[model samples]
Target chain A: MSATQTNDAPPEPGSHRRGLLWDGMLPEALGLCLVAIIFGGLAAGYLVTDYSWKQQSAAAHKAETEAVAQAMATALGCVADADGRSRAGEAPDVAAGPRTGRPSEQVELLMRELGRLPGLRSMHWTREGEAPAEPYREGEAPAEPYWEGEAPAEPRRDCSMVVTVAVRTLGGEPAGELRVERSASADAGYRSLLLWNWGTPTGITLLVFVALYRRLKRHLRPMVAIERNLHSCAQGLEQELQTLTLSDSLGRAAQGWNHLIEQLTQLHQRLQEAQGAEQADVMARFEGAVFRRVVDRLPIGVICVTNSHTISYANASAAALLQRGPDELVGRAVDKAIENPAVMQAVVAAQARSGAGLSVDHTSRDGDQETTLRFRILPVSAQSPSGDALITVEDISQLREGERARDNFLYHVTHELRTPLTNISAYVETLTQPGFDDEQTRKECYNVIVSETKRLSSLIENILTVSQLEVGTARLDVGEVDLTRLVRQMVQDNLAAADEKRIDLTLSLPPKVPKMRGDKQRLCILLNNLIGNAVKYTPAGGQVQVNLEVAENRLVLAVSDTGIGIAAEDQAQVFDKFYRATADAVQAVPGTGLGLALAREVARLHGGEIHLESELGQGSTFTIELPWPTSDQKVTR
Target chain B: MSRILVAEDDPHILRLISMWLKRQGHDVLEARHGLAARDLLQAEPVDVLISDINMPGLDGLELIEAVVPAGLVRRGVVVLTNRWDHGEIRTRLAAWGVHVLPKPFSPSRLSELIESLTSSDVTEPQA
Candidate 1:
């Protein structure tokens, strides 16, 4: 129902966390943070350890100096006693070794004691105011010592400290100075403890991290599975998300994802079902409303055939025209239905003709009736290969009969006019002959001939006019005209004709009638024909009535005649050219039988219709309806 | 006077053609159909052959095909027909150095065709 539902995977828990984890850059950030903590702690520890080590080394160097100073005081006291003293006034000669001075012997013993302390590589004592000597050892040269008035440098080994002390006799003269060197190895030992202190915790941390990673990975397995399934679904695969155990948050996430996928699948299925139903409804409407109700109900036959010459569909009218059932005609060759060679030829020619359309006349026997079929093949290229063809068959049998009747009427009329015309020509020729005499007789013959000639001319002119109307060549000059005034003028013009027939011609027009848009001459002809027919059909003392009224959106002109009316069946054929009713057969009515037909055609050319209402032996009323234009009609300048 | 051959099926139309030709001071020979027109050409010489397309037997195209190669009726030919949309007819007529005159033609059109055919010394008119 929402835009995201149509576009993306449904929302789920792992997707939400994965989105956060991606934003947080978790693994790289954790690794970098851990590395920075470890390195920063190591650096802080190194600096703190080094500072403490330097202080401890300075204390050790100070203690070593005091011990050497005590040893030097004892040696000086022994030398100051003067009992058994050496002649140089140094110390007593207490031992008989190669290098056994009391001060050197005592200094060597004190250096060995100082060496017993931890982190002491070597300890030595040097007497000042002498050549630099090594610390006195029995079998080794005396260790080097600092010269008097020279400051002792600090110990050089890492984290080591150095100290020196000066001793003097009671004579205010310098006896000797003691020098001590000590290393800061004890401080380095403490720093090493801190370095190895991280080992156990690191190992434990790694073990716990591995355990947690495996646990998290196990918990996320369902999420990964759901992800893969969702990917497949996104690609239009039908795989469903795996079921979850629902024991933890990740399990719940997987469960939620599975539920969402189920909901989406259900929605999609319902959408597909609705779409299918809609398609079926559309198809039903097309088949019911368009194909059956309309095409089948039409009077003209309709056959739709493919380019491969197979009939795809046929209407009921087509089945009737072809004298076959609808099922039998479908999927059958169109040429087999109507067994006419000319129709088949036209079909094949129409298919073969490149651009122009094909039309042909077919005569076929349907039961006892011989029907004339007019086949028109219109190529249907609206769709592809086996591009269809729409074959419309019109039953023009009645139309042919009407045309034949019109031709017969024209023939008879022409023949009838020719007789008097021939006689008049003969009379005029005789008068113009060389042996002719009598001017008065000639003049009388000429007058009779002229009248007869005029009668023939009028007959021919009427024939030509009707023929032009029937053939659709009559161009009506359309414009607005007053219907009441036009009808009044027509009635007055034909008053003498109505008087001769002794029919009471009446006009019943409203005081104000709407102006009609039409050709005045064609309207006059139409009105004249209707009025003339009314007078001709009515006997003496019969009544003929003409009325004009405005109906809804149209002007209706009704002409009612109290004459020998047409039968219900014959009323439909009255407007057909040259169709004189059977009732008029016994009556000696003289007419060209084209007046109503021409009038109907004239009304049709002006976008109007004509209807006739009549009953046998009662009367007839002919109504002509024309649409009235609105008052806002504008004329182009 | 030039001897002109006229081939027409309708007798009334053929008589009218012959009368027109005779009035123009030319000797006219007539045939009822295409086969008779061909026979006439084989037997005698003609200045031009004016024929109709839709004859009973041996239509105008076939007559032109027969006489054109045999050196019979070496003059020009003018075909008249009611079928105005036959593209094949026009192509075949042009191939045999023949001219086409559409149906419902006037008398003056026929006269002008005759005068042009006789006055031009060329055997075939350039298309």
Candidate 2:
């Protein structure tokens, strides 16, 4: 269920997360800077060489134009031409110059004519006649070489070169200086050479950059894939994987990512398990789930109350027994939920005790009735009642009632048994007296002993019957008989007792009362008991009526006695064993209290019921309801 | 002989007790239950009132309660009960100087209880 690994080599996964600068732009920008540094240095050196080449080319162009001027000057002669006199024409310019010598008038025109070169900016000669005369040239050596002419007004912004040459006659004396300015326009040949100087190196550097970029991309591809995969999986933490086969750092990084994800997945699962382990119910982790379930399913009520007097938990059985809902019981104050001071006192006492706990039985009165409860408060923890105390509240009212009943029964039986026994003992003791028994006294004593023994025997028989019926030890002998005939016979058998009391005993039987499927002997006993009780209870001259009727598919054998009747309070208990109606007249009558109880038990065993109606002084009625046998049932006549 | 009042619900037990008390040289008057016993205690001077706890009307405890104020049965009461489980009830009665005789008691035990009651003062009968 667990996997623990130790690898101390790698960085923590979270630490390696790429910052903005490190992810993509840093490597490429650094590469581009390196490329730019090397190439930029080469371009700077090429630029310096091209600047000097332009200077030298412009100088060579100007030198060539100056040489043309020098050749023309050498060809000029300042001597008199042809006539030795100045053949200065009347016009300022001659149309053609003698091929041998140059005239001053034509010199200016010829110099202007030499300005026809294509790159020529200007060709101008400064003559002595155009020079501004100085005021004090007396000590100057003929102002040799005529002060450099005022700087020419060259207006064009192009690479220009200037040359000044002195004009001399054949003897080479200075006549005037011709100034020539030439600009070199970029020609195809020059351009081809310039391109070779700078363009080739730049193109080569671009190729190198392309190769470097490819290498960087190849190296970073896995890392980028890893980052992308990790980010995409960042939400779920366990999803797609970006795998690589390279043994480089990037490949290992991928493996590391997988490992981190695995660790995170395991940790996530642990977190989920922790959440699952949380118990939302009142039963915390102190008890096992199965144990709680079993406790909840118990038939005994259980409540856990905190030291603070709050009902911390109540099981379903507790709720049902308390007649409160489970939710209503928990978190409620103990005084409110239990509401019985006696039970609460016992609970507090138990809480004050330690270890295996304490218990007390209490009877709680709810309105008119009372129920007995046994509260066993147990310790939940070492803290005892400082925490929740486990209380097992068992409603033992029924059990206490049963014990009381048994006690009453035993008491009655002993009283009954003791009476006859006492009589037998007394009479037998008298018989043993020294000659104290006369014949007549002896007969009376003997008769008393016999009757007492008979009483004892009948009491024992009835006690045995009651015991058998109560414990279900005796089974009914089921049979069918004419219920109407049986009822009439029972009444007839009881007529003597009625007559002895001077009670008017009469029978009313439906002509065709339905026969019943039952134990015929028990049915007869049921009827005999009802009628005998009626006759015995009726005063002299009071009417005792026995009516057997069939109604609603039942045989109702009703015996009503017009005598001192049982009180309304004792009616419910008339069928309880060892219970007698405690009125004066009824108490004066001597009869065991087992007849009605036995009769009712027999009736119930035969699927019937006994009902009673009475008033204190008017009369009493007892009815035995037996189910009428249907046509399918076989009736024994 | 000390005139003792015996209150019991069962007739045969009452007769047996009366006979035994007569044999013991005690003048015994009988009542079927607590009501008749209360009447007898009021109408006559008795030494001891022996009674049953459960009866139809005015049971033994009520009889004792009634007679104690009337100063009947000056020698104290002897309570006979068939309820064997009433230890607490017995204790409550014991506070009143009541002696207990459980039902089905032996004649010897009864004799001892009566002897203990009558011998306490060794005084002649007042009535």
Candidate 3:
């Protein structure tokens, strides 16, 4: 069968137009038939009335002529001779007037007898089948002298419009006919009556035509507008489907039609979903189940869009990243499912096989949290029927945050290192210059160079140690470490710095102590950072004390300083890497914020934890608690 | 002698700059940070304003942004920074028409730059 005959085939073109035209023609043809019926009815009524009018008028006309004829015959009888002389052509001896002719005498006699009647034309006498004859007085015999003495000559008259009757002698033998023509006024009356009969029906027909025309226009106008709108949409001239609405003029039909349009819109959406499913089917035919399972299990979001721009496959991660259900993403249009414009643009570009591919970042905020997803479009090269391109989405919020933190760290580290290096470099140059050959200037430059060099070396060491601690790469050099000696040595190391600032540094130890197993170098470094920071930050008269004791089966080593303490808010984050309080006192003291963080890490590595007690602007004490060594490992020295 | 104002947070670098400028026969003013430099500039105009980019209070660019517009520096402003690779800072410094000298620079070279600034006509500051 042809495609047109198939059940799945699309509707034929022009079918809507044909249907609309037919719809329009129904009312038009009906209106035309109505008009014809009214006209036909009026015409038939006019014809019947005219025929009856003509019959009645004919009878009335005949009665009028017969009465005139009878009057004329009576007049003739009055004027006729009793004897045969009057019939034979004898002149009647009537009162003699000025008129002398026989026809004039007859006319005068008839006028005198019958007087003048209304609606009378000329009167004449005629024999059967013969031309109208003259008056009886026109014969040779003279009639009585014309009544009233005078007679006028005969006037012209129509013979066809006349009513006629036979005239007879006193013996009742057939005589010549009498004829009377109707007057113009009498015929005008019949014409006016016929016109009056047709006027009413014509008026009624006109009223009905107007009513029908108005009603049909009201009923069909909305349908026509809807039809036009639909036709424009189907022809791709209009993009908005909601434009297919019927005005309220159609009443319930309008509501029903609008409802139908809504259903059609939903059907269009379903059709798009069906197209996506078909595309998925195509993809399924080309790729195996193993590939599907692998893609579904992938951590990153993977979405495949067919060449037709429908989503053929969307992995679980893709659905989750898009915040949609797994099945909701597949079998949908790429643009509709993916609300990110830049990603959609990249997908379109990839579908055209443009360039290698494009990568776009989509950032979405859900309340307080912001998620950044990177979409990379890769064009399919194998001509697989699955899809035109592949899009991979990776949630890169953490990655980007890490990059930002590293950049910040690098910036601060470089700036910190540059300060001491600049000091060292400038002082060394000053020492070389000739003006700086003096004893005081030379001594000053040497002292600056030595201190700056030491600062630079220590800063570099701190950075390396902290980075290693953070990355879990720092290997511990485990050994037996005497806690009392370690504390004494660390305090001694910071004595010169404390003395320079006039701060008292002291260490106290119990009478007896045991050496614990730990990383000795790391322990020394940790104690040095704490003691050094105490002396550097303390005021000229502030005191720092390092005390070691055994309690609770753990080594309780405390380093307390009467320096600028941490604020309550900053205390929690003071141990975080590269976190520096923005206090003026803290900023004025040149120390890497890595010290406390590194100290904590080193303490944790030896299975110990550091506790802090601080009051802003009063003092701070850092206490370390370490588990005591086991009996076999412990050495009392 | 041309008057020069040097702002640096590092005490040793500040001393070395002061020593070099003094040996060059110029009167030099000193500030420990950008805020002090702003205060000095507001007090008196100078032939040159030399500053370090990183400081505890109000950084070098901010100091220049405050003083240069008020016409405190006579010749031009010069920047000493280690943060030359910082894109936003670099762009801002470029837009200001300030000459940037990275750290670990030679004292003799710095002396020559100071000499040039004192002898040259006033360099207009860019926005």
Candidate 4:
């Protein structure tokens, strides 16, 4: 069967054939047809045999009647003549006399003489008109052969024969018919032979039909078992096709189909395994790539360690910060990295506080350079049954520096403001006293108070601005501005302060100073602060010069002054908040130390840097570098 | 007259405490930082010592530690700070019989603490 037809029924074990004999309509129809054919053949044979026997019996009976009728006619003629001779006074033939011989004997004698025989059991023979010798005396006629009237009548017997003729003695005239009687033993013998022959064959045919039915059933037993097995397979039961072993082609076909099914199932299983393996490979690659990139790109130092305290992984930042290579760090115990007892105590404490996961701040010293590190230990579990852990190390050295700087700034600013506040409060209190009510003294005190208020406001504003810039919250209103013009303007604005201190302020600009993209207000503020710092720090007779030069793709500005120079030790910390030079502190300069720090922050916001070059007693030079943008390269801020 | 050294950064607080002590007929010495207090203690023997904890360079805790060995502050040491979480201060000062008075202390409270320390039995080393 084709797949399309098999779709109508449930699928077979291996092929589209119906599993059971009765499962398909066609097989059932064929079985019914076969039964009908056998029964119809048997019925046809029975009808034919019955019809032939009836026809043969009828024909035989007609031929026997004809023969018997001819013999009876001869016998009756002989008897009638003998009786006529005796009645005509002539002596009757004694050998064939009717009165002395039985009718069967007389008929036989007559037939032998006449060459025709009569039926068997014919005892008495009488003429058609002859009466019994003992005639009926009113009601006493013989019961065996009685005559109702004196007339020529037909003879009656158990078996009888009759004869008729239309003739006169010498001329053609109607005469009485002569009849004879005989038994039918010959017909009975013939019927018995026909019955025996017909009955024997019928019995044999019935027996043969029964044997053939049993044989056919036995031969189809395997087919029935095959059907039952196929039904079980179709119903999702486990069918053992191996059990259907036969030395026939159908058994081989079944085995081949079963083999094909097993192969298909195996192929499906292998395909699933291949797909699963491919998916696992892709996931592993993806995870490895992601982990590698993240570890490499992290800015902070990181180190991972196993639960047994062996270092497993270290990033470049961690290696560099620790003053070692990544390979040297791997497989090393975490405690050996930094040998500070305090740091060790902190790590142990954090580990004790948070099992397997810890965050700690500790001070570490690498040779002469001391750094503060923040360590975070996170426990990671292994993918499989073998458990492991990953510990992460982060170096927060810069963060610690920034925090220290901020704390120092707060402490110094508070201290600086407190001095002025105390001075102002004291003066005001003194002025409020009854003895100090002079207008000149009062005006002087008011002036002092205003100046100090301005100083306090500027200090607060600078601190706030620097903090904003550090946190990346400060917005720059960037635009195209000429670097030389801005620097010259800053110098001009600070001319009075320089003149008061007797310092000569000069500006030098290249003829064609390039324009740069920057925040105009922020740049102006930065230049003013630098120039003002020069004027404030320089003593009398000091010279200050502002110069602008156009470098490649950038505009560089330099401000140099011959004033109180910063010491080498304080140069690095000059941009730090509230940091004053040791010399300047001795001189007691009247300026907040926040100017340089604020200037550095402004420069950083413009993606520029300020480089300071100075020596003791030889004024410092501050240089600012900014990127120059072409007309098309400028972006709106 | 007992010469008492008061090492306090705030001048207002110094003046108020000094005025109150002078009114009570005691000689009062004022210093703004730990260095000044050290200088003053070296010059004169103070009968009592009063100091603030948070100061530049050397704080009150270091001053207390320095004064005991120097034998300059002969009576009792009074430590003052604005910080309430002074468990470390208290613990470190316990051996020296140093009294930790939390800041925002009134002038009367200072006088009372000093009187209590001076008037008590000297053998107990009042803190």
Candidate 5:
């Protein structure tokens, strides 16, 4: 499911987004189209209303201009008639007052009446061909109808109209010409009204569009979040299913999606639990956390590699054995972690679940320390999702060393046993033969045979005891040991051997000796071995001392021999089973080399330890220390 | 009588070999270890050298190693060892034309080998 989702899901939701509504492209496009249509309609309405306003304002302006011209023409006609009557010697009656029949007075009266018309700038009358009729003016004089100081309050240059009207007499005959100029300031009010007409509707349409977009954005927010989250889930970018929930504010569709996601999460959890149960069933003894803990704490290394050829899990021991950091081996290629081709092939075979498991030993050297590791590669059952191949590594250097030691022990034992066997065989064969059978020679042969047989039996016995002690199969005859008596008896047993070499063999004991709880026979064997070795190794006239001291709640028995001592290099390994020193002095004496090892083992069984102190050509001492049992604790099991 | 040297660490084996060789009317020389045997050979070369492999001071192999090239023994060298598992040492001894006898061997067999050595003029075994 995750793979399919990852392959099918588009690049996350927010990338390359085109604005706030990018996620809902269809709605955004639709909203944009509607806004564009509304804006286009408002613009068209504005253009038409502007055109109509322009036409009405233009017509009203033309009418106002024509009316001012007509009023000026009528006033000029009255003035012209009055002037003509005065020229013809007749009195011209005027509405304001009686005329004096002077043309200037009549023109003054005409200026006053026409200037009162709101738009009239100035009026000029020409009689027949009179010299411009003095260019009749409104303010003070007719100077282009604009006074220098009072320029008609800054009138627009294009807002003025010029009208020429030919005046006629009262009988409708042409009398004089009248030219009138009027300011068209009244048209500015109409133009402002047109702007107001266009602006109000456009602003209202834009306001409505913005309000709708904001509302749509509020509704789309939850939807975009849900979409992005779904894409993330499909891509397997989110591990936590609960974090993919949509807000309840997003209505029923979102609530339904969240409910489906919740169910999916629960199903995933159940599947994992089922897998865990299967794994537990397969591993009958250990399950889940307990299995993990056991594997981690095991002395052997365990590495689990998935079918993908990568390590999925490596226990702590595995990491330590691999000499890597705790997490270094995990997620690395199996071949890379295990450099041996045989081991890698075994791992591959295990992962394939073919053939029986293969085990290989790999030897590596780091400086002076050489290590032998045994790798056992086994296949995990198919039900486990965690791993396909399980590789276990055990450091078998010590085990191999033990095997070598055992082989050496056998070789030495056989060699030592064969010496007496050869003697017994040669002597027995000589006895069977009838040549030169002197009684003296026969007596000698019988004695040699008997003694060789005894030597052979003793060697065999020592080998068995040492083997039993080493393998921990020897049953201890536990008893309260009288150290003083045991020491005396052991020393007494070795006195003859010491006396043969003319060595001074002595024993020293403290005033009080504490009894110890231990194996009596093994203790006797231990003391006899030490004391006998001292006597055997000491040269003629050398001293052999057995001292028993009880101090610091412990018993220390030390046997010091003034003889050819052990070399420093061989001292450490002297107690190892069947390890006879190759030194000439050590080899000069006949020994099976199991004495000290057996002695040490016996001491250990009694909760004691043996220590060796020796110098070449100087004397040697073997010290056995045991915890002095208290009076009440002397009870033996 | 041919002179024969018996080098052994064990007293009983040494005495038995000496007694057998002496009974055969062969002049027998005895040494407890390889070093003493080597000293005896250095003083006067023997016709046959019967040696044990394990000894103090120097081992039988080392003694033979020192003696064979120097012609310390006239006719043959015999090795008595219990280390049957030492294949490498055995191979080396074979290459040196030395005879090996594992321990607990027959006394009659040993007597036959010494008799052949004393009777033959050949210093090397026939291929």
Candidate 6:
């Protein structure tokens, strides 16, 4: 019927306060019963009091009337005794007169006094068989209906009481009858019942009920406050109960709520205080989740091994570096993860050493493929009895190759200087020997000595040139040189050498080749190298041709010779300093290996590149392409 | 007379070596470069080898690898080089039956080294 009734089933089996009986109607029934009890009590009590008042008043009226009548008889006897003890019927009748003649008057006076009783209507006397002794007194009887010829059967039947008695002489003889009458209704008793029992007690009970209900409502205020606070808490918003300053049972209930909230607040604080420790645990969980992914992305290969060299973990980097899957590297022996003896031994040695950090350079073989690596090992969780060691590998193959190239370059520089000097000394010493030479041999020895000196100087010069090119210190002497004239001059100088070898060295010029704008001496060196290599590498009866053409806004100088062409394998390295072809013609030819390297450097200095095309046992064509200069050129005499 | 092999990249040095060795009463073979020297060693069993370290193709180490591995050149090897960093290689070469002759060595010095290397009493037969 109400919202409260929705959950007002009998409390759960173990709950406090069972549901109210008759759907919580017992209190209402009790209230109704109380009202009925008060009403019934008042009504019944009013009726009983009214009824008893009537009965008792009537009985009292009858008793008082009888007593008065008896007293009248005794007075009549005394009057008779005084008149010589008159007998019952012999007594002087009060209707006649007493012997003393004052007795009649006295009887009248006594009758009037007896009529003074409350609710008394009349008092009278009569002779035995005669009429009344006197006429009725004024205001005595009003012709009452209750005074019938027969007596009333029940007290409620009449509202009046009448009593009669016979007078007796001193000898105890009956004389005259005496009678008294009074009304039985007591109105004052009815007024007392209404004021005392019915009205007053009902007003007091009503006042008590109102006070009780008001007190109950006051008690409920604290309960409402507590419920409001508890509802907030149930909604996940915490609020402490306000302390009640009362000293009643409701106050006790408020105190209980305040104590409960205080306890809850303390508990919440204890939970909040544990947050920092919980944060560390949460962070550790996060790291555990992402650790593998982060490590897999690292550039260097990383492997983790236990103290016993058991491979515990490997990231993707380690897996790829070792040519295996990340999962495949796990749970194997650390030595098996890397089979290179040097690297394996280095890891073992690093682990065997005590400190946390260790590093070693190792060369590992992937089958026939050798790779240089740098290994760095770190021991994690070192405080634990059996800690894991982290091994990282960085490939240093490029760095090692660079160092090897540097060492080879130094060796070449030294050898180029030393070879000619060795020959010079040997030739000079040979020429000085006593009788050691025929004139012809003597002349050849002197010639060898002079040429060795020139070779030594030229070797020094080439070294200086190579060094200058490497360090970017070579400066160009800018000038203009006619390509037609320069080519003819270079060709003429090489013609003698070509004739000695019987090579048909020829020069071709397009009608309009662009005049070159660059350092004259460097250009001469570049041209001399190109033409000289052609002449030197060509066998007897082979042809060497040089051509200069302008094409696509650039000058292309091409030298083609029927020389021993470069092998496919050696073509890439042919331009390196001190490189010489292994072909028979190139080996037999007497020229420093620096020629092609120097020529390319000179071409590069002029903002061009040299392109070579050749097949083994065929001929090579060297083409130099330079962008044409747009500005005016200077001509030197 | 023991046969000696001389391999050098420079023609003048090669000639100078050949002439001096001829004066020392030893038959000498001349090679212009490492490839030529490797061919000469392949053709005959020379007693001693005088080789240069720096050559155009198939340099001194390559020649040594060819000859020494086959137990050719029985009278031991003489490595001639102008390289200053050849000490480590020279030590390895000497260990493997080769001797070092730095470049600029005089003909007189060359004769002395040849005398000592060819003299059987003072040398171990290169194994």
Scored by DockQ, the top model is: 5
DockQ of each: 0.01, 0.16, 0.40, 0.06, 0.49, 0.36
Write the residue-wise lDDT of candidate 5 on A474-525 in tens digits: 7677767788999999999889878889999999999988677777778888
User: In model 5, which runs have C-alpha deviations exceeding 4 angstroms?
Assistant: A1-316, A326-336, A344-353, A377-391, A473-496, A499-524, A545-559, A568-576, A600-613, A621-637, B123-127
Instruction: List model 3 lDDT by residue over A1-637, tens digit each.
Output: 1111111122356555555544567856876788787778678767766665666665765676678668775444333322234457666445322123444466555654553544455566554356655444544543322222122233221112466666565557554566656442325555565566666677777787789778866766556656666666667884545656655545676777778877987998899899999989988876777788888999999988888888888899999988899799888888898787887788888776656978998888899988899999997666576547888989999998899899888877887898888888888888878987999999998898898888898889889987887677887777778878888888887889898899989888999998888878788878988888888778899999988888868888888999999899999999987888888678777766888898898888777899999999998999988888623233211
| Total clashes in model 5, counting residue pairs 3 or more apart in sequence or in different chains | 0
DockQ, computed on Cα atoms, for candidate 6: 0.36
TM-score of each: 0.33, 0.51, 0.59, 0.46, 0.54, 0.52
The local distance difference test score of model 3 is 0.75
lDDT of 6 by residue, A66-148 (tens): 77668767776656455443434455544433454355555555555554565556555555566564444355642211111
Q: Each prediction's Cα RMSD? A: 22.3, 18.2, 32.1, 16.5, 21.8, 16.9
lDDT of 6: 0.71
lDDT (tens digit, per residue) of candidate 4 on A349-406: 5444444565666676779877776666554443423233444456677777778887
Chain A TM-score relative to the true structure, per candidate: 0.36, 0.45, 0.52, 0.47, 0.45, 0.48
TM-score for chain B of each model, two decimals: 0.90, 0.88, 0.90, 0.90, 0.93, 0.90
Question: Which candidate should be chosen as best, given TM-score against the real structure?
Answer: 3
- At residue A296, candidate 6 shows an lDDT of 80
Instruction: Categorize the docking of model 1.
Output: incorrect
Query: Pairing residues by index, what is the TM-score of model 1?
Result: 0.33
For model 2 the local lDDT of residue A443 reads: 81
lDDT of 1 by residue, A1-637 (tens): 2212222234456654544333466567757756765666666656666566566656766676557555544444343332224556655544421134544445444455444554444433333456546444445555442212212244323654555555444443565655545454444566565555545445555666678667866655655555545454567864332222122344667557657766876787898899999999999988877766788889998888777778888888888877787688999887777676666666676666534567777776769977788888875554445667778988899998888776787665654465345446545654664433568656765765785686576567667777776575777666778888999998887677789878899999877887866778778878988987887787778889999988778788899998878888888888876677655221235455677887888777777789999877677899998777623232110
Model 3 clash pairs?
A91-A142, A102-A137, A103-A137
Interface Cα RMSD for candidate 6?
A: 3.0
List model 6 lDDT by residue over B6-118, tens digit each. 98877777877787788778999988888888888888878889988767678898889788879778767888877786687766676576777677887787788788878
